[model samples]
Target: MAIVVNLDVMMAKRKMSLNELSEKVDITLANLSILKTGKARAVRFSTLEAICKVLECQPGDILEYVAD
Candidate 1:
């Protein structure tokens, strides 16, 4: 995938657990897990906002675009 999710990096930096982030972001653990593992095909802006808000990070911190 050209779009890479850097969720794990951010999580480690924040020292937050997936379950804790899910609760704080008001998202499901299963869905957040998919994002953490870089398995998500797409992420809604609203959800992204929630994640950024909870993680105190920018979207760029979690997502990256790499040319194929």
Candidate 2:
């Protein structure tokens, strides 16, 4: 199983850039990049909320569960 990150797709749909998201979410670019690229091990709710709020999306928009 895997938790697929749909960050790239969401970002594209939102017409937002990584740097812009990082700044808007008040998160570090490097860390946000890690999450964006699906390299992050976990994500905090607050951070997720911030992302959602800024992107006008829910966690589901960024996360997808894949069966093994």
Candidate 3:
């Protein structure tokens, strides 16, 4: 996948647990895990916004584009 999800990195940087982020973002643990593990095929902008809001980061902090 050219688009990499760096959710785990941000979470670690912020010292937040998956459980805590899920609660703050009001998302399911399984879904967040999928995103964190880079298994999610798509993410809604609203969801991404909520995550960024909770993590105190911009979208670039969580998502990265790498050329193949």
Candidate 4:
């Protein structure tokens, strides 16, 4: 995918576990896992906002665009 999800990197930098982030963001672990693994086809703005707020990061930090 040209749009890369860097959620794992940001989580590592923040020293956060998937479970912790899931609880903090009020999202299901399965859903977060899908996003973290770049398998999600789309993400809602509210979901992104919640994740960014919990991770103390911007959306750009978690999502990147690279040419294939």
- What's each prediction's TM-score? 0.95, 0.96, 0.97, 0.98
Q: Model 2, 14: alpha-carbon shift in Å?
A: 0.7
TM-score of 1: 0.95
Residues 1-68, model 2: lDDT tens digits: 29999999999999999999999999999999999889999999999999999999999999999988
lDDT of each: 0.93, 0.94, 0.97, 0.97
lDDT of 4 by residue, 8-49 (tens): 999999999999999999999999999999999999999999
Ranking by TM-score: 4, 3, 2, 1
* Candidate 4 whole-model C-alpha lDDT, 0 to 1: 0.97
TM-score of 2: 0.96
Question: Tens digit of lDDT per residue, candidate 1, span 1-68?
Answer: 89999998999999999989999999999999999888998899999999999889999999999999
Model 3 lDDT per residue over 16-68, tens place: 99999999999999999999999999999999999999999999999999999
Which regions in candidate 2 have their CA more than 4 angstroms from the true location?
none
Ranking by lDDT: 3, 4, 2, 1
